[model samples]
Target: MEHKIQPLLNYISKYIVLSKKDEAVLMSKLIYRKYLKGQYIAQQGDVCKYECFVISGCTKMFFADEEGQEHIVMFSIEDWWTADMGSFITQTPADYNVQCIENTELVLFSYDVIEELYTEIPQLERFFRKIIEKAFVASQKRIVRSFSLSAKDRYLYFRNQYPKIEQRIPQYMIASYLGITKEFLSKIKGQLIIDQ
Candidate 1:
């Protein structure tokens, strides 16, 4: 059981020094969960209380408009974290829904438990802050791509940034993330195939 947590501890260790005892304590508060494909891990209007780290498979965060069309915010793969930052930090309802795109495994740490851990293991505070900085950079990049790049350029950028995502997610979902219609994406893909 503790061994199952080593990967998560190893992930944190890159940013902070966790003593054996601290690792044990931190692992004790972590909860492992599995979700089948198409399962909702968190929904719009629900408060996101858990900060989840993906262990395997893929998940996406999206929000629906008044027409009920989903616009994908981002995708989370193995070793990546997923949460509605606004909801998680503010303890308010989320504007996005997070769902598994495939059978997924994740480790969830509650906000309260993480706060306690930060207090007990001060080094974790800096570690988590770095995580926030990475999230900010990603968000900034997404915004810049959306505003300054064409859909094809954005698609290519996304593919370059997450080289493995094309193999993992459905084309329709990727199209949604790129803010382009499925047909357009198909055309782009066809062109790529020709170029290759």
Candidate 2:
């Protein structure tokens, strides 16, 4: 359990310096857990109480439309942090679901605990602020790409961005993330191969 936190500590150190006491406090608050593939870490309509840091494996954050179609919002892997931000901060129900795509290990922090940490270690607040800023920027870019790029172009971009992930998950999930049909993604991939 102590060793499991090294990845998270290393990630945080890249952004902010932590004193030994701060590191101890942070580690004490972390709850380590495991989830099997297809298990939900969070679900729509539930209050998102924990902000999770992935130690291993993959998870997807998604939401279903009224028509019951799931739209992939984001994918999180090793060293990535994930939570339904609005719900986690506001203490309200989540509009999205986060589920493991493979057996996963995570270090989780509850909302109150994180708030306490922020007060105890001001640097942690700065670190999380930077994390959210990057997340926002990536969200904006994704929105722009959806409007400006063709499906095939978007697929190519996604492949470039997450090459390892592309090989790990099902193609249908990738198509959903790209906002395209599985058949369409298959066709695009086939055409790209032929063109090459």
Candidate 3:
């Protein structure tokens, strides 16, 4: 698992350099876990216990509507982080559900463990701030695109941003993320093919 965790160390290094001591402390608290496809990592009403970094595989963060429709907010794949920020920070029930899109391996930090890490390694605070900033920025961009872009354009943006993820996620899931119907997504794809 150390080898698997090396990627996380590498990722964090890109943001803030960690000393051997700091690295050891951070790694010591991380929990390695795996979930098979169709497993739920976090449910709508359960407090999120872990802040997970994807070592490999994919997951979706979605919410159920009054009609029981699932609207995907985002998908996290290899090297990405997935957690309900509100739930994790506030220690409250999550509004979204995070489910594995495929068999997934993750390195997780519990809420308590992360707090300790922050105290032990102050630079880790900066690293996490950057992570949250990126997530927040991406979220804002997604919100803007939703109102301004056509469904076809949104699909194209999604494809360009997540080419690998596009292949793994089902059409219906992708449609939900783009706020379109599955049938409509099919039409958009067919039209794209014609244009190409």
Give Cα-based local distance difference scores for all models: 0.89, 0.93, 0.93
The regions of model 2 sitting more than 4 angstroms off are: none
How high is the lDDT of residue 160 in model 1?
A: 91
The regions of model 1 sitting more than 4 angstroms off are none
Reference-based TM-score of each model: 0.96, 0.98, 0.98
lDDT per residue (tens digit) for residues 133-194 in model 2: 99899999999999999999999999999898998899999999999999999999999999
Model 2 clash pairs are: none
Q: Once model 3 is optimally superposed onto the true structure by TM-score, how far is the C-alpha of residue 141 displaced, in angstroms?
A: 0.8
As a TM-score, model 2 comes out at 0.98
Model 3: residues with Cα > 4 Å off, grouped in runs: none
Model 3, 29-105: lDDT tens digits are: 89999999999889999999999999999999999988999999999998899998899999999999999999999
Q: Worst 10-residue stretch by lDDT in candidate 1?
A: 1-10
Model 2 alpha-carbon miss at residue 26, Å: 0.7
